[model samples]
Target: MEAKEIIEEKQELALALPLPSTIAVAINGKKKSKYVVRWALEKFVPEGLHMFKMLHVRPKITSVPTPMGNSIPLSQVRDDVAAAYLEEMGWQTSEMLLPYKTMFLHKKVQVDVVVIESDDVAKAIAEEIAKALSISLLLELHLVACFQGSAASYSHFHSPSLPMQRFQALSTINRTLLHTRTGSIETNSSRRQSLDIREEESFMSPCPSNSDIGYAPSQVSSARSFLTDDQSWISDQASTSDAFTESSSGSQVNINFELEKLRVELRHVRGIYAMAQSENIDAARKLNDLSKRRLEEADKLKEIKLKEEEARELARKEKEKYEAAKREAEYARECAEKEALQRKEAEIKALHDVKEKEKLENALVGPVQSYQEFTWEEIVSATSSFSENLQIGKGAHGTVYRCNLHHTTAAVKVLHSKEGHITKEFQQELDVLSKIRHPHLLLLLGACSDHGCLVYEYMENGSLEERLLQKYNTAPIPWFERYRIAWEVASTLVFLHNSKPKSIIHRDLKPANILLDHNLVSKIGDVGLSTMLNLDSSICNINTGPVGTLCYIDPEYQRTGLVSPKSDVYAFGMVVLQLLTAKPAIALAHLVETAVQDDQLMEILDPMAGQWPMKETKELALLGLGCLELRRRDRPDLKDEVLPALERLKDVADRSRDSAPKVQLAPPNHFVCPILKDVMHDPCVAADGYTYDRRAIEKWVEENDNSPMTNLALPNKNLIPNYTLLSAIMEWKSQSNQ
Candidate 1:
């Protein structure tokens, strides 16, 4: 059969079976005695045949007075009794089964005969009621006997043939015995009545005289022998008869009252014995009925248990099915997620390829002959999409990344394309950088206008500001090198301002814009703000405004909102001050001017630069001050004054060393102070006779007041200048600079 049909058939078969009846067994207030009774009933009663409810019986109190005058209220008495019973049974009295009382009245209570062990009064009352109702207890007992495997207990009472005849025989025996006893009592009473009547009749009628009867001694002797066993009773009776005869004047009276009295006592004894036998028969009948009910309950209980087991099995199977379906769903979800991830990766690659193709097409269509054009894909692949490791610098305008392209190293400046004005700036920078070419200026190798990126020759040493002020625990920038860098930047500025068609002013000029190559040569870069002036028109353009880094911006340009060559000079002056002081450009212009006016220029100089040429240092400082003048006309031009003056200082330093005696080039001796190993710097002799740089010795003495060479107290504690060694160092410095 199909599964569905099989299930239906099983259900139909289950319905055909009889449902077990529920039986409630009442326990009369005594819990300890009920345990054994409950156990036996439950064990022998099959679980599927019947279900048993164990109920505790509590007495219902009624308002009644005691034999004493005092009357206790029923509610109070009931509570007290309930509490005591609960204490004994270990139950809450409030939870007692109240319905059992009604069940008892309705004959729904299935109490066992075992209850007699705990409460005899209740058992006696129950048996009396059952007997009065003529309820057959034997049928119930027979059922219990079967379950208990003791059916033999009722064998004598049960008859195979003529089962109804046996009941009839019992009924007849009971009636006959009662009637025989009653008849005996009636006969005795009737004999007594007759005797009384006879006595009364004799008293009123004529009596027989003694002279009419002949005395027979032989008959009298025979009667006396027969009554010898009761001789004393007979003598008493005879004396009484003689007395009666004499008193009645020869009238004879005979009485046997003692014999009649003995007979009446015998009948009363027999009646009492018959009543006791009837009570025993009734008790046996109730016991039989109780056993029969227990057996029926056992059968019903067995059936119920079987049904419960089948239900549990069905539930377990359903749980396993649900878990299997859940696992399948989870597996399907994981597969879908993996597939989606693969599709997303494929889409990204396709997009990257499309952008690359578009850039190559644009390059081929509109190529700038001045420089090469790079595709965005080539740049991204080289720099790994501008990963943090390849990024060299970040700014408001753009990010600079170090990358390799076509076997050549390059710097990629990727401009911010979010703002509309930034595109104009990008084109302007590309225009300016592509046209200009100088050794001290950064070279633009290629441009990608579509992607807003500019490719240029990569500088190995980074920016001038980074080398001078950013590093720690490194040799300082020598005065000559600083002078060289300042001159190189000024020359680049001169070139930008002196171009043929129209001079370009580098609106933004600072140490950051000045980059350093592998050889530490200074290079000017970042011409995004450079604007070409119209030589034909003398008047300034109103569109041009004060736009440059703070502190580097000229005061005249800021106030007038005009672009001029002097504006670049003013910004270059700030860069010069930064080179000299090794401090940031912000507020350095005003601070330097104040120091120069106060004659504290030496105090503000970078000590790490070592001893400077005093006259040359003062001259450079004064030139920077002039460029920073508030009036644009007062500031010196880069081509005429700043560049020429810087070149003169470089020449003078070189000529002085050339005129001195030459010394063999070699590393400094081990005995020399490690701090003052540089050439042309101030050399001084301390108490330990160790030659150290003048500035280094002074700073050490000021901080520790001890000789660095010996790590001990100084005998002279003062540094005396070594003029001869200074002359030799100057010659060596000049050779190194060449």
Candidate 2:
């Protein structure tokens, strides 16, 4: 069965809700925050008196780190200058409220400004600002008392309106708030209408819809008084009728009947009013339930929106990941392709290099190829099938064996196994080694074609690299010997570079390739990475590819991919520095340069290399730094500038070695002046009374009035002749064969 329900004259009334009493605005003392306050005022601020709470969330000040240095955030304001923190905040609040103060005063608004110093608000400052901009945190809603009513509506006050032309308002209200809160008998007469309203309605215009909603005891009492007054008036009418009834019967009867009808109609109206009020209570209950359901639906919609936003953010991240993955995949594929192409090109270049090496080796063979050749059977017999004990040394080129060949103790170098696959670098090394005849160059004796073995004269020592490091716990090389070794390497390099038709550039110039004999004489050993170029206008050997160790490679050659004689000079510079300091080659130039600039070069010298001669060592270091120039043109010419300097240093080292047994102290080192360190020509004394050269002391006094030896202030610029010291120096020089 279908059931039907109906509400009779119970439709919901369309009435305005209570206006918000407070609009809480959050400010950050920023210009954008003022825009937010202005927007709230223009948008939906109701047509009623309101209180705006200007809540400013002051940021907590602190220090943070940056690239340049540690810095404080916004360090403009000072506590002492601004009186105190509270007063400063007050000033800031006033500054922010400057724009809207006039408008707010005219409107029915009051402001209660406050500054809150809280870290939580500072942390979520962005969120708070957004909430304020959305007006979600600005306005706080409350169900205040029912809205004020006007004269035309169900009003209880009998207040009268003033004359329109005069436009005067006379209000005697206690101003506890904007509107009077207490005192029942308050008078307000305005030109338009009064804002004060009463809870109860007029008896003649009773709104039954609002009868049971928030009705107080006062309203009930007022209703009872109106009913009692009506009853009194009816009783007075009845008494008059009774008096009239004794005098005139006809008129009294008609009056009595009309009075009874009026009483009946009043009772009927009272019954309807009571029933309508009861129904209004039920309707208000139903409306409250509906409002709750609406709020729940709104909450559900907001949750769904949040979920959708999260999903969109996730999808966007996924798209970015996919794009990044695609790019990585493409890059990996390109790298694979490039690696394959490089491997192919390297193979082709290897084949071409082998052919060139073979042609050059054949051309240079002349009579060097006539050396005694050992058969494969003889080599196997001598080495005991290449026994492990017979092996003397192992290197990148091949293995060396101590074997007796042709009644001679020879070092036989054999190529690696399965490397009969003929290579380019080894052939070049063979061609150059077999033809060169320098005492500093390793001598090649013979070869075994079957296994690519070459016989060379045996040297008791290993290589320059091992000797410098003292790899087998050997004694450290003395400074004088290292100086001579540097000289030999330079002169030998000059020889190869000045070869007859074409010049040879040793691409690999490092310590490992230099060999040392029993006498500790160093020789350039490996010639594999070398290339011969035509002596043309071009300085660098640009015909061959660049290949060498990292630190020894010249900067210009590494940048432009060309090999030149100057490149060898650069490597020689690094070698010279290593000999002086005994440090690793990596960043050696930079370290030495910094030391020299700071005048700490003496501190960094190798303590193992027996007490270095100070003057010669400094000169060598300066020369090395000059040779290590970044540009090839800036470097010293190997033949002209460099060779002459090395020869001079070598002569000093040779004299020191040759005269080890002699006590040569005729002209002692102390005879020279402390400042200039030269034999004092015109010896003199200064105010500090130290004997010094006349010119050196005068220059020092001119720049600074201080003693050169003691660094103390001089009394006066005086040069007393030190004739006695001068006579000793002169007699000593003459006796020393000057």
In the order shown, what is each candidate's alpha-carbon RMSD? 29.5, 27.5
How far off is residue 131 in model 2, in Å? Answer: 99
What's the TM for model 2? 0.39
Q: Write the per-residue lDDT of candidate 1 for residues 1-738, one digit (tens) a residue.
A: 122232233334323423223333334444343343343243324333233434333344344355798766656667776566446544344244443333333433343322222233334333433333222111222222332343444233222111122223322332333244444244433443343344323322322322211111111212212222222222332344234334435433323334434443344344334434544564577588788888877877787788888888888888899889889988988888898889888899899999788778878888545788999899898899899989998777999999999988899999977477788888888988887788887999998878899998998668877767855332456666788888888888898888868888888898888888745688888998878887664335546545778888877777777668888888888788888899977677788888888888899898877677778888988888788788888888778778899999778755654664443333335224567655427788888898888788878888886667678888766778888787756654554455
Clashes of each: 27, 0
**TM-score of every candidate relative to the true structure:** 0.40, 0.39
Q: Write the per-residue lDDT of candidate 2 for residues 1-738, one digit (tens) a residue.
A: 000000110111101112224455555555565566665564334434366656666555453334698663445546553345446556766777666565566665777665665565523333443343212234111101121222223232111110100011111111122133223212211210231111111232343433322322113312333333333333333343343334355776666656754664465466447645754775687699889999999999999999999999999999999999999999999999999999999999999999878878877884436467889887887788899988988867688898888777778888786353245666777788766778888788777866778788877567767667767655567777788988888888898888867788887888877787756788887676787877773365454555788889988987888778888889989888988888889999999999988988888888866777888888899888998999988999888888888888988887776765422222445467889988898989888878888998888888998788788888899899988788777766654341
Note the Cα lDDT for every prediction shown: 0.62, 0.64
Q: By lDDT, who's the top model here? A: 2
Model 2 misses residue 520 by how many Å? Answer: 1.5
lDDT score, candidate 2: 0.64
Off by over 4 Å in 2: 1-370, 417-422, 537-545, 661-738
